[model samples]
Target: MHSLNVALGARSYPIIIGSRLLGDAQYLLPSIRGRQVCVVTNETVAPLYLARLLDGLPGFDKVDVVELPDGESYKTLNTVNRIFDVLLEKRHNRTTTLIALGGGVVGDMCGFAAACYQRGVDFIQVPTTLLALVDSSVGGKTGVNHPLGKNMIGAFYQPRLVLADTDTLATLPDREFSAGVAEVIKYGLICDAPFFHWLEANMDALLQRDAAILAYAVDRCCRDKAAVVASDERESGRRAILNFGHTFGHAIETVQGYGVWLHGEAVAAGMVLALELSLLCGSINNNLLERLRSLLRKARLPQRPPAEMTVVDFLQAMELDKKVVNGRLRLVVLKSLGEARVADDTPREKVIEALKNCGVR
Candidate 1:
């Protein structure tokens, strides 16, 4: 097992990454601080792994499982309320621990439920999907999506533990796995140039699901994200760098409708747009842009925004991004191959041009 700690002082927790960790009681039981436990998962995952997880928690006083309907479309307050309904019906107290046992959608809703239930409660993340293992399950960001924007209504509620069982990746579909690769590649683009180069060289091994390579990629992304989250827990400054392509990405999700494009798929295209904008703004050389584009192609990710989207659609959706300050749109763009900066000063014309360049009408 490869174990790492996210240092949050009193709220510090460990992330365990390894094979066949799902049914390991030693890992799961140690994280729970209370007798009562709730396991939140999705329909797709419950059939495959829920029994294994439940079997590990034999000592708990009470264990409840809420099998949520899966997918991005279900990431809403209404779905989250279902958790509350079950918790209340079962008379769960503040001491209850919520275990998110599925992918990003399940983790987000469970964490949100834990944060809001009885004011607050502990939660553990058992991210089954690659995206959750690498990104969403690590940071404290939790919330249901609002109709107006992605993650617009959420909380910075960190999980007590993040247990990523690489074994879970066995069942993930090819499309979903590639989506996770986008986030892995984001770390290299935003801050780790060598990792970027490494990915460029080893994209094939990763796509082939070479165990060691996949584990290393997951751990590297986690470490990068952990450091940033520790430094800017509330996204007051440096943390926003982590949203490198998310501004443009969220716009795609909002305009196209949630679940139509997976978050990672949208981010894949969004990163391309951000790269184009960076090139136009002279923040990065064309060589760097082309390199990322080539790397993305190797990963089978989108190289541009969706053809159906327009410049106006992007502008309108981005205006609703959380990064907007006093009506000015802010975007995270690359400063170099390995570094990023938040740019709110770019002229509106440049934004439109970048979108147009990427095939936005």
Candidate 2:
């Protein structure tokens, strides 16, 4: 197993990534001074790996499992409230530890529930999806989606531990697996060019589930994310680089409805848009833009936004994105393959043109 630490001083924790990590709970779940434990998961993942997780938690005398409806649409305040309802029924207190046992939706909701339950409680992340393992499970960012926006209602509650089991991914559908790759590629685009090159070479191997390559990718992604989080835990400044394509991606997801375009698919297209904008602004050359697009295309990810979305609709949806600060639309744009910058000063007209140029209507 490859382990990376998110150092938050007293709240520091470890993220373990590898095959069969879930079955090794004695090493994964440390003593947290609590008898009550709640494992939150979705319908799809509950049947597949929940039992394996339960077997690993044999030492815990009391364990409660909450199975939520599976989908991005269910990530809401109501779902989080349901978690509270379960905890309340069980009389769980501040000392209880909540284990997020599924993908991004489960991790975000469970983490937020832990944050609000009796003020606060510890939580662990056992992310099943590739997207969650590479991105959501690492950062302290946690929340539920709103009708107005995705992740609009949330908290910055960090997990006590993050256990990513590569074995769990064996059952993931092909589209879902590709979605996860989008986020994995994001880590490379934002901070490490060498990793990006590695991804270029091993794309096929990763898709085919080559254990060594997947392990290396997961470990490297986690290490890079941990380093970024350690430097800027709260996204006050430097950490915003992680948002590389998220501003546009969130808009696509919101406009199309939460689950219409998987987050990674939207990000795949959004990265294309960001790259176009970068080229237009003279930050990255046209050749680099084509290379980036080619990489996304090679992964079977979208290079353009959905044909149905209009420019006006996209702008309206973008307004709801969390990146909007003081009415200014802020975006993380790539200067080149290994560099990114958060620009709130990007011209609105240029953004509209780029949207049009990318066939976003």
Candidate 3:
């Protein structure tokens, strides 16, 4: 197993990545004072691997499992309330630990639940999707989407441990697998130029599920993320780099309605738009822009927003994004491959021009 630790001093935790890690999670969970445990998952994931996870946690005094209807739309206050109902029904106390046993949706919902359940509680992340494995599971960011904004109502509660079983990818659909690769590529684009080049060379191997290559990618991504989180656990500054394509991406998701485009797919196109804006701003050269687009194309991720989305709709949605600070849209743009910086100074005319050029109406 390949293990990487996110150093947060007293809240430090380890992320375990390997095949069959799910079955070994019981040994990894921290032994807390309370024996109450709740496993939060969605219907789709519960059937396939929930039982295996249950088998791993043999000796807990009481275990409660709540499976919600699966989808992005279900990530709301209602779902979080359902978790509260379960916790209250089980009479769980402050020490109860919540286990997030699915992808980003599951992780966000459960983590938020843990944060609010009796003020605070411990939680573990078992991210099944590659996107969640590389990004969401590592950060302490947790929340449900608001009707007006995505991730607007959330907390920065870190998980006690994160278990990533690469074996879970076996059940992922082709589209979902491609979607996950978007986040994998984001890691390279925003931070590691060499890893970006390595992905360009090993795209085929990654697609074919070559274990060694995947293990290396996951480890490196987690290490890069750990350093960032340790430096700015509450996203005071440095951690914003992790949202490289997310500003435009969240706008896409909200404008198009969530789930129409997977989170990674939106990010794929968002990164392209960000790169174009960077080039227009004279921050990155044309050759580097082409290189960025080429890698995304090789991964089968979208490079433009859906044809039907209008420019006005996108602008309205972007205005509501949580990342916007002091009424200005804050965007994470790349200066070159493996390097990114936040820019709130980008002109609206330039952004609209880039969107138009990319075929957004």
Cα RMSD to the true fold for all candidates: 0.9, 1.1, 1.3
Question: Which of 2 and 3 is the better model by lDDT?
Answer: 2
| Candidate 1 per-residue C-alpha lDDT over 1-361 given as tens digits, one digit per residue, 9 for 90 to 100 | 9899888888889999899888889998888888999999999999999998887788888899898999998999999999999999988899999999998999999999999999999999999999999999998999989888999888989998999999899899999999999999999999899999999889999999999999999999999999888888889899999898999999999989999999999999999889999999997888887887887788788889888988889999999889999878888889899899988898889999999888788
Question: For model 3, what is the alpha-carbon lDDT of residue 110?
Answer: 96
Tell me how candidate 3 scores on lDDT: 0.86
| Candidate 1 regions with alpha-carbon error over 4 angstroms | none
Candidate achieving the largest TM-score: 1
- Indicate the worst ten consecutive residues by lDDT in candidate 2: 24-33
CA lDDT of every candidate: 0.91, 0.87, 0.86
lDDT of 3 by residue, 57-149 (tens): 878899999998887888898889999999998899998989998889999999999999999999989898887888889888999998777
Question: Tens-digit lDDT track for model 2 on 1-361?
Answer: 7677889898799887777877775755673568778999999999999899887787776799999999898999998889999999988888899999998999999999988888999999999998998889988899988888888998998888898898988999989999999988988888999999999899999999788988898889988899999999889898999888788888888888889999999999988888888877779888877777877887889889888989998888887787889998888888888888999999899899889889866
Output the lDDT of residue 303, model 3.
81
Highest-lDDT candidate: 1
